[model samples]
Target: MDVACAFPTTLDTPDNIAMAESLGYVRAWVYDTPQQSPDVWMTLALAAQRTERIGLGPGVLVPSLRHPMTNAAATATLAALAPGRVSVAFGTGFSGRRAMGYGAISWSFMDAYITAYRGLLRGETVEWEGKRMRMLHPAGHAPARPVDVPVLVGALGPMGNEVARKHADGLYVTFQPPEFMREYSWVPYLAWGTVLGEGETPDSEHARLAGGPGWALAYHGAYEFGGPAAVLDLPGGEQWLAVVERSPAEERHLAVHSGHCVELNEADQAAWDAGGHSILTDVTISGTRDQVRRKLDDLAAHGVTEIVFQPCGPDTRTELERFLDAAGSHLKPA
Candidate 1:
C-alpha cells in the first residue's frame, strides 16, 4: 500500500508534518472547511516546505466554496513549490455547515463549479458574468512542459464515482468494499483508512477519540441524504442538509459494526470472509501492523492504489506516530 498520513484540516499543526517526515510517511492530507478548519492550500504550502518527499493536499475541498479558477491557481502554485509531489481531492458536503449555524449550498452549483475550475486548470478561458476568466499564468508554458499534479474526487457512491471517473485523475474512496469498487473499474483509487489508536484497547478508545459524535453527525447526513453520492447533482440538496442539521446528534449516529479506532478479533482473524472486513471496517483502519497489512493487501487485491490514513482523536501526533510504527514496514517504496 502507498501509506500516507491524513491531517484533519482542523488539527494540522506544523509539528505534525515534521513528525510525519521523520517517520517516513509519504503524504499529508488535510481536510478543507472554511468554518471548521484551516485553508487547505496554505496549510499544504507550509507543510511542503517542512518536508522533502511527503506529498501535500486537501482530503477534499468543495468547489462550491470557491471559484474554480482560484482553486486551480492555488493548487498549481503548490505544485510549482513541491514539483512532483502535490495532489488534491474534491468532494461535496461531509460537514453540514448549516448544522453548525450556516446556510446550505446545493450540489448543482458544485458540479458547475468543478466544470469551470477544470476549464481554468486546462488554461481555457471560462465564460463568466458576460465575460471570460482564465488562469493568470498557467504553470505549464511550453508544449513539452505540463503541470502534472494528480487530481482526485471523493466518491462515496455511484453519482460521485462516475464524476470522479469522468473528470478527475482518480477517485478518493471511503467505507466501501473493494469488490464493489471493482465493478465500476475505478482506476487510481485512493482508499481512506482512519485509525484512532493502537493495541488491545484501541477499538473502544478509537471510537470515542474519533469523536463518535461528530462522525455520527456525518453519518446522519449521508444516510438521510441517501448516501453522500445521492446528493450529487440533486437540486436544492442543501434542503436535505438543513434537515440533518435539525435532527439530534444521537439520532443520526449509529455504529455500522463493532470496534472503534482499531479492529476486532473477528475482523483481524477472518478478514477474507465473504463480508470480511469491508462493511464493518468502514470508519477506521486500526489494528496491529500485520493486521493492517492484511487489510491493505485485500484492498490492493481489488485495486486500491493508495491508502491514506484518517487521523482521529485529540492527540493527532500520538496517533500518527503509532501508525508509522505499525505500518512503516509495509510502506517500503516499490
Candidate 2:
C-alpha cells in the first residue's frame, strides 16, 4: 500500500512536509480546523513552495467552516502553485465543528455543497444558497478553470459513503478497518502510533507523547457522538466522562476537546494517568519496525490504498523520520 502522512493543524507543518517529501511519502495532508491552527490553504501553499514531489491538501475540510466559492478558489490557488500535486477532501465536520460547539452537517447539505464546489471548479455557474456563481479568474489569476484536483469525502457510514461514491473522487476515513470501496480507486485511512524503541513498552513516556492523541480522540469523539456510555469502556476512558460531566453543559464541548492532538489537557491527562496508555498501543498501529511493516501489509490486503499516518509530539521531526524508516520505500511521493 502507498504510505501518506497526515499532520496536525500547526503552521510549522510545512517543514515537516518537506521532510516527508525527501523521505518519499506519497502525500502530505494537514488538518483543517481553523480555530486550532493556521489556514489550511495558506499552510498548503507554504508546503507547495517548499516541496516539489509530494502531494499536498487538507485531509478533510468542514463544509460549515467556509463558503463553497471560497474553497473553490483556494483549491485553484493550490493547484496553481502545486499543479498536479494537489488533492482536496471535504468532511461533515469532526474536530473543526465540535470545537466550535456544533455537530456534523447533514449529508443532504454536504451533497449540495460538494456539487456547488465541484461545479465552481469546472468553471460552471452553479446555484448555491439561492444564488448563482462561477469562477471568473483571468489566466495567471488562478489556474485556468476546470482545475482537476482530486476531491475526497471524509465519510464513515452509508449516508456519507454514498455521498462520497456519488459526488467525490475518493474517500477519507478515520479509525476504520482497512475496507475497500469498490466505487472509488482512492481510499485514505487516517491512522496514528509510533515505532517502539528497543525494549520500550506502550506506556513509555515516548509512546504516550507520540501516540496519546489518537486514544484521547476516541473519548472526545465518543462523548460527542454517543455521550459518556460510548467512551466509558476504553482503557482509561471511564475517567473522561465524569470529568467532562462536571463542567457546565454549555461549556462541555470545549472541555472535551481542549489540547486536542497537540498534548493531553488536564482531563485527558487524568485519563492517561488512570490507564490510557494501553489504548494507544492497542488501537493505534504501534510496534517495532518488522511488526509495523507486517501491519502495513495487512492494511494493504484489507483494501487500504493509502495509510495516512499522523504523528504527534514535540519532536515531530524525529517521529516523522522514524515513521518513514518503517514505511520503507515502495510508497513513492507524488
Candidate 3:
C-alpha cells in the first residue's frame, strides 16, 4: 500500500510536507479547517514549491466553504503549479463547519457542487447560481483540456458513499477497518493515526498513550452527533458518556474540541483511562512493528490502496519519524 501524510494547516506544513517527501511518503494532504488551520490551498501552494516528488492537495476540502467557481479556479491554479501531483477530495464539512457552530452541508448542495466543479475542471461551461460559467482563460501550464486531477470524495455514511460511487475517483475514509474496503469497491484511501514502537505491544500503557488522542477524536465525533446510543457500542462508551454527563453541560463542547493531542483535563483524562487499550486499538495503528505490519497486510488483502498516516502528540515530527522507521519499507515511491 502507498503511504500519505495528512497535516493540519499549521505554519510548518510546507516543511512537514518536504520532510515527508524526503522520507518516501507518496502524498501530503493538508486539512481545510480555516478556524483551526491555515488556508489549505495556500499551504499546498507552498508544499508544491517545497517538494518535488510527493502528491499534494487538500485532504478533503469542504464544499460548503467555497463557491464551485472558486474551488474550480483554485484547483486549476494548483494544477498549474504541480500538474499530475495535484488531486482534491471533497467532503461534507465536519470540523470545518462544526467549529463555526454550523452543521454539515446538505448532500443536495454537495451533489450540485461536485457536478459543477467536475464540469469546470474539464474545461466545460457549467450552470452556476443562475448563469453558465467556465474557465475562460485556462493557464498554459495547467494540465490540458480534461484536467487530469483525481477527484476523491470523503465518505462515512451510506448516502455519502453513494455520492462517491457516482461521482468521484475514490473514497477517503477514517476509523474504518479493512472490511469496509471489501464492501465498498471504489479505490480506497484510509486515514488513521499511527503510534507504533520497537517492542511495545498493543496493550502496553505507552502504546495506549500514543494512540489515545486519535481514539478520543472518534469518541468526540460520535458523542457530539450520534448521542448516547451511538457511543454505546464502543469499548468504553458508557464510562465516556458518564464523564461527559458529569461535566458542566456548556463545558462539554470545550472538552471535545480540546487541542489536537490527548492532554485532556483531569476529568477527561479519567474517562480516557477508563477506555484502556481497546479504545486505542479501535481507531489507531498502534502496536509493535510486527503487529502493525500484520494490520497493513490485512488492509491490503481487503483492497486498501492508500493509507494516510496522521501523526499526533506534542512532538508530531518525532512521532512521524517513528512511524516512518517502522513502516517506511512498505511505502512505494511516487
**Number of the top-ranking candidate, with lDDT as the measure:** 2
- Tell me the spans in candidate 3 whose CA falls farther than 4 Å from its real position: 138-146, 177-188, 198-210, 232-254, 260-268, 275-278
Sequence-dependent TM-score of model 2 = 0.95
Instruction: Put the candidates in lDDT order, highest first.
Output: 2, 3, 1
Candidate models: Cα lDDT each = 0.57, 0.83, 0.73
Better of 1 and 3 by TM-score: 3
Identify the leading candidate in terms of TM-score.
Answer: 2
Rank ordering of all candidates by TM-score, starting from the highest: 2, 3, 1
In angstroms, how far off is 274's CA in candidate 3?
3.8
* lDDT by residue (tens digit), candidate 1, 72-129: 8787778777877878788774542432333344555555677777777677778754
RMSD of 2: 1.6
Tell me the tens digit of each residue's lDDT in model 3 across 214-314: 66676667766887687666766677677767657666655555554334444345556665446665566766666666677777777777777777655
The residue ranges of model 2 lying beyond 4 angstroms of the native Cα positions read 178-183
How far in Å is the alpha carbon of 181 misplaced in model 2?
A: 2.7
RMSD of each: 8.8, 1.6, 3.2
How high a TM-score does candidate 3 get? 0.85
The residue pairs that clash in candidate 3, if any, are none
